[model samples]
Target: MKVHFIAIGGSAMHNLAIALHNKGFEITGSDDEIFEPSKSRLEKYGILPKEWGWYPEKLDTSFDAIILGMHARIDNPELLKAQELGLKIYSYPEYIYEQTKDKTRIVIGGSHGKTTTTSMVMHALKDNNIEFDYMVGAQIEGFETMVKLSQESKIAIFEGDEYLSSPIDRRPKFHLYHPHIALITGIAWDHINVFPTFENYLNQFEIFTQMIQENGSLIYFDEDEHIAKIIKNKREDIEYIPYHSHPFKIVDNCSILKTNKGEIPLEIFGEHNLQNLMGAFHICRKIGLSDESFYQSIQYFSGAAKRLQKLADKNSCTVFQDFAHSPSKLKATTEAVKKQFTNRKLIACMELHTFSSLKKEFLPHYKNTMGSADEAIVYFNPKTIEHKKLEPITKIQVAEAFGGNNVTVYTDSDQVITDLLEHDFNHTNVLLMSSGNFSGLNLIELAEKIVNKY
Candidate 1:
């Protein structure tokens, strides 16, 4: 297979490029700008573009397919060349479908927990000696790349993102993957820039469920009210399996899952994690994994990168870093850490980085979301709002929106780092949550400083 990628330096695009390269396909990709990790990883595979900018002269009819990324504009030179030549083009998920169409596809989608749930299934399957192609949003410990594809594998697992696909293809990504097995962990309002409203955001999931292949199964979190409402319009052509949080107890700060045969100790702790685990378990079972094997493999699963990642533990203080910017994600991460470490002073710091979180209209959804944290610190760069071209907001509005006098807001990055380091972290636990780095704050370094490691 010969594939050319436009805007290939994207998180998903680069991984797919690497995966295809590994599959022995001739791969070539172009991007105007490529950052660390993506640039380095592509270079290691010997497929990194020598020139950064897209060139129309790089294209021809010899290419079997053109994969477009969301980062690329509709007028991208390479994309225009591909279209001019009338070559087939695929969005990230669209190409994934073309590659895995013959295989059983399991897509996990939700506003939250999809990455963790998808990672859990991938780790368990690989741990049990199962060969499978998979794609997840976050990196997993045992996996070398975020996207993997193989001819020998009979199943493919994907983290189904609801965000728009290519700039040209406005459809949500998950809509393209017609999954034989689909699981939605839960739903909450997010991506207000594209989705505009809760109903509009929700309609995408409804369309995704409807896109399931005939005789496919829909595994969902029954506890979510939005999901509950969706399942009301159930289909007879597919089987529906609803799951809730698996029975677990916090033991010695470790999460333990209760099973009929025995209790399994887990490295991950959180109610949302427990629910994610259950969602993964159901997907595993459908693929013929025994309950015993599932629990055994899952016991060793640490977590997907940046999802409740432990950064420091010393002097009776623990620091957790998570990719949680949405209100639901923020609420869940804060609650989980506080519940598990009830004795400690829970200081939660979050960055209002995403377009949704920075918007004035979306602020109210965050009301009381961080109440579990003993100290709630919110950070946002005013310039970020300007960059997004949004209406300017105030620290007062942010503080009030959180519905707490405890909620403190900051516009400066260094001040946040300074205050966190200055505070006495002894017998305290800190949760740093955001999709973006707190305006280039090195969180790992920050965590180490909190524990006196640096």
Candidate 2:
């Protein structure tokens, strides 16, 4: 199959391109600019575009399909050309559905925890010698690529993102993957630019539950009031299984899961992670994995990348970096670290990077979210607001929004780093959280410097 990709330098798009290429399909892709990792990986497959930017001449009717990325604009030249030629075109998720239509599709969806939960299922499946096609949002350990497709696999697991599929496709990516089995980790208001209101943001999931294939099952976190309310009147044809945090205890900063076989120690921790573990448990059981097998396999699972990933550790001082920008994620991650290291001082730092977190109106949602930290720091770049075309927000506004005397807001990345450097790393656990890199701050290097200081 000849598949052409527009704006293929995206994290997910490039991974999909590589997956299709590895499957022995003819792959061609272009982007205005390609960054490291994506650029090198695409080149390694010998499918990297010779030149950057869209080429109208490159669009041909002979191409079997055109996969569009969210990075592409609605008026992308190649997209317009493809539309003009009347060729088959699909958003990323739409194409994924087409590929897995015959397979048992299992989709994990929510504002948060979807990636980690999906990774857990993938880890278990692989460990138990199950062959399956899968697509997860993050680069997981033991997985060559985030997007994997195999002709032999009878099942497909997908990390269901609620974002728009592509520039031209307004449908949520998860909605297109009409799953035979589904999991909703939890619902939290996000993507303020798209959905606007909390109710509007929530209705998407309500629609998603209804889209599940007839006689399919929905495994959801019952603790979330919004999720509970939505599923209360769910489709009678579909089965609903509610889950909560698995039975676990923190011992010497290690989280141990209580299973039927025995107490299994976990590499991942927190109430949110325990909740995710339960969701993964139910999904794995539906996929024919026994409880014992799932528990055994999950013991080796560390975590999905950037979900409270340990960056550097020295003595009692450990540094963690998490992709947590949303209010709920920030709270959960902060509390998780604090709960784990109960006796240690916690320094929770987060970057206000995403569209939702940068918005002045959305700031109040973060009220007291970082209260678990002994010292809380919030960082935002004013220039980033201008680049996103968002209204400028002040450090004072951020401090007030977070509404805590311990919260210290910074507009400069250098200053934040400087302040962090000055702190003594005796028994303090530092948690750096953000969806972005704090305006191009190299976190790994920063973590090294912090760790070396001790």
Candidate 3:
């Protein structure tokens, strides 16, 4: 199989290109810009283009398929050439579906916890020596690539994303998988540039639920009212399994689970994580993992990348960085850190980088989300807003919308870095949350700085 990728340097796209390359398929890709990690990884695979930028001349009738990334626009020359040739073009999700159509697809979808839940399932499966093809959103500790596709594996696990599939495909990526076993973690309105309204954003999930294979299973978080409503409307033939936070007890900053094989300690904690674990448990059970196997395997699970990931710790201070830009994710991450270290002060800072978070109308969803932090800080880049072609917003508006006197807002990246450096790190746990780099503030450096100050 020969696959040509447009905008191949994307996190997911590059991973998929590598996965296919490793499968002994001929892989070629082009992008105008390629960044670190993706560029290096692609180069290591010997598949990185000699030069960046699209070349329509590279498009040929001999190619098997063209997988398009969201980073590629509709007018991309390669895309236009592929269309002109009437060649097969697949969005990331569409191609994934085409590849895994014969397998029992298990898709984990929701506004939050998708990566963590997908990681939990993958951890359990891999630990138990279960062979499976998978695609997760983050670079997990043990996995070489974020995507792994094999002809031998009977099942495919996908971290279902609600974001648009591609420039040509307006549908959400999750809508294409149509999983045989699906899970919805929770719902919060996001992607304002696409959906525009909360109800429209939610309807995508509803559509996803409707797309589930007949007589298949739907595992959901019963605690979420929106998810409950979706599950309630499902067909009777489909199995509906709802899970809550897995039974666990915290002792001396350690989280132990009440398993069938007695109590077991876990490397990861947090109510949301426990909830994600429970959801993963149900999905794994349906897919043939025994309770004993799941429990034993989940013990070594570190967690997905950037979901409360421990960066640096020293002298009672721990620093974490999370990809928690949404309101629900922010609240959950803040609460998780606080709950885990009740004795220490929790200082949380998050960047408003996404389209929804920066939108004036969507700001209300963040009300009280960051209130759990002892000192909550919100940062927004005016340049980022301008770059995204969004309306200008003020720090005062953000602080007001979040509805907390304790909240500190900043627009300058250097100010945030300086403030973080000056803040008392002794006996405090720090969490830096954002989907972005906090406007180019280096997390590892910041984390080291925080840890060293203690």
Candidate 4:
């Protein structure tokens, strides 16, 4: 297969390009800009574009398919050329569906825990020697690429993102993947830029549930009221399996699952994570994995990258960085760290990076989300807001939105670092939560400096 990618520098796009390249497909891609990791990874695969900008002259009917990424604008020249030629053009998710149509698709979808839940299922499948094609959002421990495609694998597991598939394709990414076994971890109103309203944001999941293949299974988290309501009215042809947080107890800072086999200790913790684990368990069971195998494999699962990932620890002070920008994720992550280290003071810092998080109307959703932290800090780069063309937001407005006297807001990344450094690190755990890099601050280095200070 010969495939050309437009805006191939995207995280998922580059990974898919590599996966297809490894499968011996002739891959070519173009992007206006390419950043680290994606740039280097693509170069290593010998599939990096010869130049940065799009070249419409390169587009022709010879290519098997043109995969489009969200980064590409609707007016992208290459996309126009593909359309002009009447060539097959696939949105990232659409192409994935086309490739995995023959396999049993297991899609994990929700506003939160999608990556972690998908990672858990992947780890379990691999540990049990189950060969499966998969596409997860995060770079997991055992996986070389976030996406892997093989003709031999009978199952395809996808981390079902609810975001728009492409600029031209308005459908949510998960909607394209009609999964035979689907799971919705939970839903909290997000992606306000696209959906605009809470009800509209929620309707995507409802559509996702309806998109499941006939007689397929719908696994969901029963604890979430919204998810529970969505599952209340279900199709009799589809199997509905509900899961709650797995029965577990925290023993000396470690969470051990109370399973029928025995008390199985896990490397990862948190109520949300336990719930994700339970969701993964049901998915694995449906895919023919034994309970014993799932338990044994899950014990080795630490977590997906940046999903409450521990960066550094020293002198009773630990530092963690999480990819949590949404209100529900921020709250759950902050509470998890605080719960895990009850003896320590929890200092939680998060960046209002996403379009939703930065919007004035959406800020109020974050009310009391960081209340679990002894000290809460919110950072937002004014330049970022301007770049995104969002309405200006002040530190006071952010503070008021969070509704906490303990919350401190910072506009400067350096100020945040300075403020954090000023604090004594003893008996304190620092949790840096954001979907961004805190405006270019190297978190690993920051974590090391904070840990070494103790």
**Best candidate, lDDT:** 4
lDDT of 1: 0.93
TM-score of each: 0.99, 0.99, 0.98, 0.99
Q: Please write out the lDDT profile of model 3 over residues 191-295, one tens digit for every residue.
A: 888888778888899899998999998888988988776666669778888888999988878889987799999999999999999999998899899999999
Over 57-129, each residue of candidate 4 has an lDDT whose tens digit, in order, gives 9988899999999999999999999999999999988998999999999999999999999999999999989
lDDT for each residue of candidate 1 in 73-124, tens digit (9 for 90 to 100): 9888888888899999999899998899999999999999999999999989
All candidates' lDDT scores?
0.93, 0.93, 0.91, 0.94
lDDT of 2 by residue, 1-454 (tens): 9999999999999999999998899999989999988999999999899998889897888999999999999899999999999989999899988888899999999999999999999999999999999999998999979999879999999999999999888989999999999999999999989999999999999999988999999999988999987887768799999888899999999999987799999889999999999999999999899999999999889998899999998988899999999999999999999999998999999999989999999999999999999999999999989999999998889999999799999998999999989998888899999998988989989988888895
Task: Give the winner by TM-score: 2 or 3.
Answer: 2
Clash counts for all predictions: 0, 0, 0, 0
Q: Which 10 consecutive residues of model 2 have the lowest summed lDDT?
A: 227-236
Please give the distance, in angstroms, between residue 327's alpha carbon in candidate 3 and its true position after superposition.
Answer: 0.7
lDDT, residue 195, model 4: 95
- Report the CA-based lDDT of candidate 4 relative to the real structure: 0.94
- Candidate 2, after superposition: displacement of residue 300 in Å? 1.3
Candidate 2: segments with Cα more than 4 A from true spot: none
TM-score of 1: 0.99
